[model samples]
Target: MTHRTQLNQAEEHLRRSRENLPVAAQLLYAVADLLVDAQPAEPVTNRVAGLAFTYAGLAVLAQYPQAVQDAALDRALAVVPEARPSETGGEWALRLRAAAGSVR
Candidate 1:
């Protein structure tokens, strides 16, 4: 499948399965979807989007019942220190941590 098609599928899956996920997981997935959906064109925008995607995905994965390897969370944790405050002064890393903590 084309890259855009794959992204669309992933977004649809997230939307359909969201109710089954913890609130935090849903939020993180939403962030991931948004980052990919933007289809960033600039180099810097692309880099930021890639980081957001990895951070969001890893945060969600770390919340799973059986939880993936510690390396996933470690990578996600590494991304947090690089996060800059959003234009509205919100912190994405904090939101990600809250979501990871919310997993059952």
Candidate 2:
């Protein structure tokens, strides 16, 4: 399957597992691992960052340890470009940053 397809499946799993924190966290971690392995390009990187941000937020909501949340946020931030030209990309990066701040 394509990376996009895999990412979509992982995201679907994450959403479906929301009521089960352990499952959701596992899926989120899987998604993060996929993103890391893919090493996606510009616009795709933006999407990956958004997914990571969501994972971090879910980690916080699920009462995960601070280190886990920080790691998720760090992975998200690490993928974001220092300068994204697309408005949507910039917006997603900003949202991720905001989510990171709130998680801490």
TM-score of each: 0.33, 0.29
Pairs clashing within candidate 1: none
Count of clashing pairs, candidate 2: 0
CA-lDDT, candidates in order:
0.50, 0.49
Model 1, 34-92: lDDT tens per residue?
55444323223436656666665565565555444345445444433343434111344
Where does candidate 1 have its weakest 10-residue lDDT segment?
Answer: 81-90
Could you give candidate 2's per-residue lDDT for residues 1-104 as a string of tens digits? Answer: 99999999997885665444433334344444444444433454556656654765664435666776566546544543343554344344444334333332
Candidate 1 ranges with C-alpha deviation above 4 Å: 1-13, 39-102
Candidate 2 colliding pairs = none
